[model samples]
Target: MLDGIPPLLTALASGADASIPDLAREVPEEEWPRLLEIVRRHGLTPLLGEAVLPHGDTCPPTVQDALRTHRDYAMLWHRIQMNDLALILEALGGASIPHLLMKGTALGFMVYRHPWLRLVGDTDLLVPADRVEEAHELALGLGFKVTEEWADAHHLPALQRESNPPIELHHQSLYVPTPEPGYTLVPVDFSLLDAEAGTVDAGGFEARVPSARDALLQLSCNFGSHMEESIARPLRWVRDYAELLGRGRVRWSEVEERIDFIAPDLRTTVLMSLALARPFIGDSYEPALLEAIDGLPNPYARLTRVVSPRDMVHEWTTSPRRAWHVLSCLMGPWRATKWSLNKLLVSREHITRQTGLSGDALCMRVYPIAFALHAIYHLRRADRSRGE
Candidate 1:
């Protein structure tokens, strides 16, 4: 599975004619559409258009034109995003709320060659934990409505308004729970990050982004968490890490010291991210940094080394492999086993919610039968769809 990067992806990412004369030429004519779909799904269409549009006559006119159209749409989408960001930042500023931009939106401004080149799904803003509720209310006052919520989530339920991107109002850095007892990946201290954060000129406005070190930590942890959530694209995340490293803002020595002092458990998450991105990054990063990452003990060495980034993408797209990948992400076999058990023992309220059946004494008695019938129905429906 660790064979190598996919050729089409290499062509798209590196834009090297030596890799392929035409990106479309790398795949069969019939497969070109599927390839384009993969790129779009993986959040590479903006870059794809930019890469292939310049090499006229190399790719099919239809391919080039389609990519160019998507590229133009991405640019237009970016304008909408920027408008929303400005409005959100203005609201926060007017209220005197200390807010720092996080994730893709911030990286777009601070690291990417062009803000639109980095595809963003939503705007992530981190406010002080105490002010998060106030900010959430502010978002509501500004017309955004809550779309999703989870009790233990790091961010408040996601908020969105019509004609604008969703907003994840975070109170703290996200954390990943490891198999190690009572130990989760180290989370960034919002206060420390806030103090060290620097402002970027976001088109007539000043918005704060996390310090380089904190930003790297956040990306690494996010990679781990999103993998478990089945919403991550290896190519997208690896590109993020590679781009960030290319900026040369990080101090490896200081990052190492911070990891060691604050939480060594975070080392694996950071190492895994860099290690995966290393192949794509080529000689951009320090050899010493690679050496240090290699020297550190990696419990997932076999799993990480054996699975290529392309394999990661496949694991998400293909079944059985998808199940296996999710199991691996449980951190350990014992944890995975425990999780399976806990899932089977879900509470009565969960059953009530799922079946919309009353939780009365009679319903409680019949709940097992009802749940089994529901499961059977779901499995049959899935099988029918698959067969179709």
Candidate 2:
């Protein structure tokens, strides 16, 4: 279980009535840096400002300055993102393309008290799968260039405008490629989200956001998949869920039903996400939802003593390897075998793109060389771990 969670974070998540002044007074000046790092790591810098800036005098001058800087930077970026979004929305609307905002961009408007309080690192806009290429064309027409690699199965390559955040035109909400060619383990049902979507006004234009039920499920799927895949823990997701649930906006029954109907395989993932956010939600969670979570099959039950934010933070921070190892075990041997086979038999186009090399002979030779290098990488990591 995670231990030594800074009290500052707990107070921050403790709702509107939390005594930020008392918490700030109790915090040692020396501890500010560590707390700030934790907050920053979780994408909570702007949120920290919201909670602490009102009681700024209680904090150290340096910490106050840092918080202000983070808040100002986030606010500025947020405005740029909104302006860029407005233009993109206009372009898409003109083309008669249907789009729904997803992830942080959507959650900021739907859940947060103030949109800027939710820091959007990038904009995620979902378009119908069939229309994604057309949407991609529209994005390019708007002078946004593909600043990255070729489009993946889930979305077009991230498009960026000079001096602004990147935009991802998504055909799928989430995609987890499996070792099997032409198969993805997790592909969100766009129709469900699209059908139940609601519109929110972004200054001058209207943008679609997933309904509360869909929002919670999408967040759960994203959060659960990340943890299971050993992706970095971002506390902002917990905050988003906390805000939605704390305000009594979510319909737990609908969310649970949707999960069961569309993706029963993700039941555990959804539970893990909810379990992690449950403490932060205080008394807001529905009793039936808690009961359902308790009743769900928990494969990771043995791995974690407590499924709370503190423990999650501890697990990720103190020993990322342990978290990875547990997730690897949960992923099972079949997935590992499939992944290895997939790597060995990578597409010719991918090989050419990656190595700038062509021909069957050269690509065949790359197979052995790639395997050796991969083996060496893992071997070195194992040796380092043993030595430590």
Candidate 3:
């Protein structure tokens, strides 16, 4: 079992109301002071302060400082995220691209009563594949230009500007590569333009958000589709779920039915949230959902432990290795091989476009040399593991 270091530390010093004893049991006595000191320095003291002690227990000064720092960092990051979200929404709205806001920001607007707690690092927008080019042009027209373009057309291009925040324009909901014969993971077969377009008054300009149900599905896909070794993103999902459940706006039965139809294996997503957030929300999750989640394989189970937001985001956003891993797991052996070959071909085309190098010239070029290094690094580990 991975020691629940990050979560436990957060709970103790961050005013995170949860059962810490069970989590504390996972930490060795010798490591407690170190963990406590880290949490205090990180500004989690308000949450992890006196309330955490059993009876008449005292905290060290170092722990206090860490907690304060954590709170400060969190507050600063939330402001940054909020500002970015506002900027992106303004740009998109100006472009007239009817977009569906997804994941963290969507959850913040719909579920998390306080948007600050949702903690979005960047903005994610879903536009239909057909409108993708139009959306890109519109963003550029509004001063947001493509910062980094991925080689695959299936992937969204990363957009940013000098003064504005970054926006990821997703053409599809789930990016399952081509040549992998399976159902396409597109967005809900409903018109986002006609959906109830609510606005969020974020002090300056109002930010448009998606419907509650769609936001829920996006969050479900965000958690379910990616590797879940990090705790931060899953924890954010748990917070969103708890708030959504508490509000009682969405019918539990309806959510479950959609999960069955849209994302059948979303049980993994629910389980990871339940496991990490159980301390805060308790085991009040629906019985059927709990049972289904328990049946997922070990790899899925390992995702619940992922705690760093950066790592979790990279797994979904840019990591080629993670994309390949997810494809291999979902599509079996034979189909995955074909998918891998197709990816190499696509990568070659991507390289060619980015740099004016092709064929034999490309093979003998520096760009190909770098690509080879990346491929070798990715494959070499697998080769060594097999030999082991």
Candidate 4:
């Protein structure tokens, strides 16, 4: 995967017209499709193709057609998600849910390309904690089914409907599950940013997104939460951060002030994500911000450089392989200890939900075996990375 980095990074960071045939020649046939998938997962399929089209790489006809097809489907999904967003906004409005559209929807429309080329799975709706129940009921009234709920996390739960994309009614936009630095059970209040939110028309559905400063801050928090969850923060996030920085609207002064005001802890979150994103997305950060990122103490800030990030689903169904991957991902002790705590304490209910396992003795028994195997796997990986 790393071998394809040159072309992939060129596609993302450069605007030059390139021959696709020439780029293809650099990558052996066996590695081309993998390269395509990497760019596609990073939400750069069409953009990469656009970058290469002028130079004209001699991509095999079939490979070119496949990328074209993937690009078309991604565009179509974006449209469908928008249509779903419109219906959802209309429903929430009718119910007076007082919700704001989060992440993909807002970024796709406002920060990204005019047509919004990325794919959105579910539309995230931010509702006040006090009104989460009302919003959940509203989703139910609109024929959406409640699929899951997490009281610990600020999100009320998830709602899905066949007619539209799934709606996640969020009481909290950002959640940090680990206590390595500090423990805050209540996810950060996004209402603080609501005042700065401005409305945009989402295919005739009036919707709101945070101002540029808040969006960057909020995205930073979300990225931090995903990392805390031991979930691979996707490359798409890197793209989003890149584009958000490119927007001239961001006010660093206001953003830093808010960080001081609302969640000063996210100072590192913002710094780290920016540091990690620059390699793939070319640097667009302010000089002060770049200096701040550079000055961040290592061990934590440098995790992005040490780890291979991927966006993998986090659920009970995720394989043991993923657990091992996360276990071995960053600097050892902290992540390892946290994984064990989550497995023993935080994950019992998750395991029960997935496997119907219950009782203290049985669960504790399962933990010993799982922990030992995970430990062994981590050691083996360390040995491999060390060539021992």
Candidate 5:
């Protein structure tokens, strides 16, 4: 309820440490409307409710009614998702294909109280890379409408069903952990999917969820990517981390080692997650993780954990030194060179996808024009910034 804090920030890091009475006392009754709206926007109804429900009878029924309403709505979606998941799993079982559930859906049944309170929007299931085509076929057989685009670099394009959340069948994870002689990015081994992860007891059937350690990575990766957007991702994601951490299963040291292997550029999302969760600047986070965050080549990159990339860009417009630091941290000479090479060579397929043009001749012709326009747009934006 602090006025000075950015409107985009629903809950500050310190709020995690504050009790419901403290929150209620700090946010006066006149401000409850705004506070409630913030909590609602951040998907924190159940989380906040759980913290303060002991005083339910003392408080107004409207607040209780709101919590119950949100929980009821979430529960309905949870049942629907479970049913849909069962149907998909049954089909996959018949086809002898095993899969791992990812993100909110996985965390719903496994990490949280139930899938209902967690509020999943869609089902994200990771199938083995070899089985992606087969899974795509199975989805088609099950009458799912495929939302295909050209050359999906990561996961297979989403497939949809009527009146149900869309299913995204993934072959590649959001952060591709490719460890090799010439390593670009590396994290955990896929073997951990089966070996470390356990099956969730979903009444009659079971669903697979990542080990607690791995869940941290997934949660962090998802959080890092979405932190800049003033969307519900960070709100729900923060609670997810809280829930997972509360379970008391994750080993921070092991998690740190794996994060170190991936490098901060790849693990930046998780690092940002830790900053929000533990507030590395504060006391909640461990020293090792903080060390890992500090180990990133550029120290200024840490500012991104608190403020968004867009907000930082605004700051860059006013300050040359900060701008230079950000540019240098994100783009070294070697990375810049590799990026140019990729744009000239590997970007052709990506360009084709962007343009929705299939033929090589047409795509190649359109790409240079697209690149030129993109460059011009950036240059104009820079010039405007200089003027500002």
Candidate 6:
């Protein structure tokens, strides 16, 4: 099943432009049946063929099978979102955290026709930075253990819950690395919280969400930071921005002012989002959106292309290199080196705590091989540069 279906599903997931014939040619003939079953289960077959398959006179049998089995997976993804949101709000209320729902769920409840139509995996909640520790305690009290214990042990405040439907607690608006030295597009300023809580009924569950302006800023900063697949969680932010614009919830000028003041570097991401969702958002924002695009730096301006191929792969994979990259991005070069060394030391300490190994013994057993590999890679690169 994996041999046949994994590659095909991967292609579809990555928005690849392979045709039915093209896919059939690549897939192993013996595994085609199992591959088709997996594709049907995911409900991606029809969307893949109709939206992605190239025009051709000859179509593969798998194409027809996939089309027949295709259901809207987006809707299913949405139902999961609704269930998760319900759980998140319940957890927050139980914990006594005065939370504001941030991105996808908030947008869906406020603007979209059906909340399930917008695909979201987890629910995001915002609390004051000062209240972050309180929020974590609240989540723990409600049975949601932080998923990344290593991160928590390292002093990163973000925590994930162990609930069937997980909730992520954010005290800081943007993710900052301990080793990385850089300012975010959105500075960690809890002063921006001017809370105006209102309730929305989702299938009889009441949800309390953030104010319109703050919600927009949170979503904008999140999208800006992770520009690669901002579009993956679709329609929520578009609906929010459009509805806010339509209702005069906040003036266009005020939105622009907040964008400049809070997440100035996100101008590129916001404009790109407006452009992608223009079909849903409409033409009125085109001029201002283009102007925002023009204001972005050249690197950011080309963000769409910059986050291609390997970028998407890295995001989905759990390779150590990706972990290292995340560490590097959070902490700049010098700090990353120091952090890695400290992490190695701490890891040894933890190992010693669990086992009876002394610190020097653990370091001798572990550090030499790792350090040797680093030395070999650097020396080889230097030799290549000198025509070795």
- Worst 10 contiguous positions by lDDT, candidate 5: 176-185
Lowest lDDT sum, 10 consecutive residues, model 1, at: 379-388
Q: For model 3, what is the C-alpha lDDT against the true structure?
A: 0.51
Instruction: Evaluate all candidate structures by whole-model CA lDDT and list the values in order.
Output: 0.65, 0.68, 0.51, 0.59, 0.56, 0.48
Model 1 pairs whose backbones collide: none
Q: Which candidate number maximizes lDDT?
A: 2
| Alpha carbon lDDT at 161, candidate 5 | 71
Selected candidate, larger lDDT, 1 vs 6: 1
Question: After superposition, which runs of candidate 1 have C-alpha atoms over 4 Å from their true positions?
Answer: 1-5, 11-31, 179-187, 261-263, 296-298, 317-320, 329-334, 337-349, 352-388
Off by over 4 Å in 4: 1-4, 13-30, 49-58, 114-116, 149-152, 180-191, 228-233, 247-251, 302-305, 308-346, 349-388
lDDT of 4 by residue, 151-185 (tens): 33556666766644566777877543343432244
What number of clashing residue pairs does each candidate have, in the order they appear?
A: 0, 1, 29, 11, 0, 5
Better of 1 and 3 by TM-score: 1
Task: List candidate 2 segments past 4 Å from native.
Answer: 14-17, 174-191, 228-231, 298-300, 303-308, 315-320, 332-388
Q: For candidate 5, give the lDDT of residue 112.
A: 63
Error of 3 at 59 (Å): 4.7
lDDT of 3 by residue, 17-113 (tens): 5555456556555676766644333223333433444422234445445445554554565566566556666766776766666667666566644
Task: List model 2 lDDT by residue over 1-388, tens digit each.
Answer: 1246766676565454267667777889998998887776566777777877888677899999998888887778788888889888999989888889988779989988778777665688999888888988888988999875756567788888995778889888743322344235566667767888999988778999998877776677667545532233446676787777777787677777877777766666666667767666646788887886677554544333334466565555334344335444545544433333333334556767888875544435564564444344444423322201
Model 2, residue 336: what's the lDDT?
A: 38
- The C-alpha TM-scores of every prediction are 0.79, 0.80, 0.60, 0.75, 0.69, 0.51
What is the TM-score of candidate 1? 0.79
Candidate with the greatest TM-score versus the true structure: 2
Order of the predicted models by TM-score, top scorer first: 2, 1, 4, 5, 3, 6
Find the 10 residues in a row with the least total lDDT in model 4: 309-318
lDDT of 6 at 140: 66
